[model samples]
Target: MECWVPLFEIFLNSPCPETQASLWLQQSFNQPGPTTISTSSFLSLLTKPTHITITDSSSPSHTKRVMWIQTLPNAVQARVLSFLHYDCRRFCESELCQLAETMLKEGEKLDFWVKRAAHQLLDVVSRSNYEWFSSLNLDSEEEQVENEFRSLPDWLKDDVDETDLMLPWLPISQKQFNLAMQFSSCGENDDPMIEFEEGKREIVEQVIEEVDEVIKEVDEFLNPQVEELVERLKDRLLSLQSTSKAVELAGEIRELCKGGSQSLAILGKIEPWRADDEITSVLVSNLLDGNEDELGWRSHILCSVILPKLLVLKEPASRVLLTATIEYCKIHQRAAEYALLLPLILRTEGINSPICNVLTRIVTESLHQGHVSAFCQKLLSNEDDLKKFICLPCHQSLIGSKLVWTDSLFNLMQNILNHNIHLTQDSIDRLVQHAWESADRFSKSLKFGNFLLCFVTKCAPMLKSQKSLLTEATQHTNTLVTKSVLSKLSTL
Candidate 1:
């Protein structure tokens, strides 16, 4: 009963190949052919599950040996015999024989006779009849249906006993029942009071049980005498056992202790197989393969716990964990915590992943809502992989933030302008334009007017030839920069 029988019950109850072959053999017995077995012979011989090899004397006919030669349950065997279109049902009837074979005089049947018959008949059959079920050449019509049924969880196949579940006869008197039926039958009107009373009583009973449990737990924890008695009993029990047995029993005690709600306090500790890579892979697989009912909770666990653990680890292991987080977000459509990890993941792993698009969307939305952390801002300023993925709002948030305008801003801007590598001139221009627009649109903004101009001004000698840089700078300049914003554009 404790072995998870429900999981295998459906499969066990399914039509065995032997059963199908039994049906086929019964049909063959009724056919007009030399290969068919006579009813008298089949009944007498089939009584023992010894294999029977039937061969066609006709030219080029293949012989089949039905080898299931063991006793099938009476019901199943009877059903198999009924497959014959003829009067095969007569074989299933008992008390038909005038002389019943009684074994009262003997201790048991002769083992010699049984063994001789079994070796010859079964050895001749060579294999089970069930193996030839495919020889009947069935269609693929039931293939998909069988596969889906096979994949179903065992609990779905288990039939709960409704005998225990059925409500007892109503406790009300016959007069009360008649009155209730009369009211219930009149225009078939529903009585809300009747339904409400039943539901209200169940809820009140449940609440009282929960309250009693809470009070008991409180009393147990607060009572010092109970704790002392438990400690004394534990010491006495250990004292009674030998040292080796005591140590052995200690493992069971530890395991029992690790199974309650209180055990979750150690989720951060090792021994949950934290050191094993195989364990992580298995945990991830189980999460992904969990039934639809568990998926929401699994996703919550992934985001709240798994993600923090992954972030602390080194990748490509972390990369695999990151993929799990994004794939979960991409499929489950609930990415609140995962979206928060996008920036840290982007900074650490970069954009070489299948879930980059999911990550991009997460980052854009997070940045737009100003949900990104300060560390993410520094990462965004440095990492170019996610730079192109950033939306206009994200770019605006980055530029207008106080973090971006620190002393490093001058060198960062200078390197960005001089590099002229991954980002195009037009893209850089648009970024500056959007930054100015975001600052102006928001009530409070950074004074990028001079800071940004300083970068261009610091590189004025180098940009004197590239007037496009001066023109772009001039376009982004505002009142915060009093000096000719772009010194190279002084004449222009």
Candidate 2:
């Protein structure tokens, strides 16, 4: 252990890197060496990594240790590089990319050491940074800022689909048309005279026109299949009770359209059933009616089927669906904010409608327990209706129902109290009240007490044996819990 201390001291005290590295390398191979070099000095040796040499036949553990040391943070990487150089052949391509992406996401400053290491990697790839740079067009200062922060530019906000990048259906510009023609044409029948060449050009133009006609014909021939696919998409949309799928389907159709697909032609083929009404029905059914089966169907209809259908309408009652949704929730006493609206911001119809006013009134009036339970049962049964007629109300209703479930509230509180030390006063109060109420209600009926205890002692443990906080909390608060349990019991 004492063999290398004098050698390490001499290496550290040495001014020249070559001398220090020579001594360090000689001692690294020697067994029983205890060097008292500081972390900074050790790091300096690592950063100049060329000094250390291990054979390819070294044990896996030694290789891994060397690699791990090299991949450490800025100070560590620098020290390791001094000894090992910035070579990273041991890491997988995907793993390196992931690490880079993570570092970029974390807003870590690109220190000199990190940049040098990254540059060495760039050299290994031997590809021009410009080509990779072109793929991410963050040339502008604003774009550069957004990119550095791992965010997309405003221009890319709507470019949500991977397929959109591959599609070639966008209307062709005059320049693109010329370019396409230029690339398509190749001939050896050359005219010597300039005037004769004009004739050849005319002939080529005619041939290009013919090719364009053929392309158009091919597109026309494929229209039927595209139309069939669009119809299938429409059918799927209309059958869904949730609008979530509508946004996704919209993206899919957008890609199809961009791909020069003839799916848009099927919009004309839809039967004259009112789209707004159909969409309204879907929203109501999912949000109020609790029809999970029709959820996927409704999503397709709202954004994909309904919006496009509305665009085609001679007199589009676009607001009808939104109004109907709000009004239905009002009459049904459901909450007003729809969760689907979060994603479907572009498709939502109305900010102010009679249905919304009614929903507000219903939520305000039915905030109490007796009214809430009655309202919840009705809303749960007719979730689809609520979603169709009033999406916001459906969300509000669900949120309200979740809050109203005192047993769930108690458990949630107990969990926070036992597991989370950073509990806010409001959360603590809310949970305490919920637990107290649940305990009060349980203590009144012998059957309820047995059921509660049995569930905590048996079913829950079987399901998740590791956590017993809920059982413990309920037991600790048994007396106060029993008192509240009795009070609620008298009413039940």
Best by lDDT: 2
Model 2 lDDT, residue 163, Cα = 21
lDDT of 2 at 419: 17
Query: What is the overall TM-score of model 2 with all chains considered together?
Result: 0.22
Candidate 1, 344: how far from true, in Å? 4.0
List candidate 1 segments past 4 Å from native.
1-266, 269-273, 276-278, 288-296, 313-326, 335-492
Worst 10 residues of 2 by lDDT: 163-172
Candidate 2 residue-wise lDDT at 65: 30
Candidate 1 residue-wise lDDT, 1-492, digit = tens:
222132123223533322234444556567774752444444444443344444666755554433232244434333333222122233433311210111111224424333332322222233323444456556564565444533424553332121111111111222333344444432346676775555444543443353233223222232364345445434543343244443343343334333232221222221222323333333444433323211123323343334444434433444455454444443333223322343224333322222333344443322211123322332344334222211111112222212222322323333333221123333344444444444333212233454455434433334445556445544544554535455435733
Candidate 1 CA-lDDT value: 0.35
Question: What lDDT score is found at residue 447 in candidate 1?
Answer: 38
Q: Least accurate stretch of 10 residues (summed lDDT) in model 1?
A: 96-105
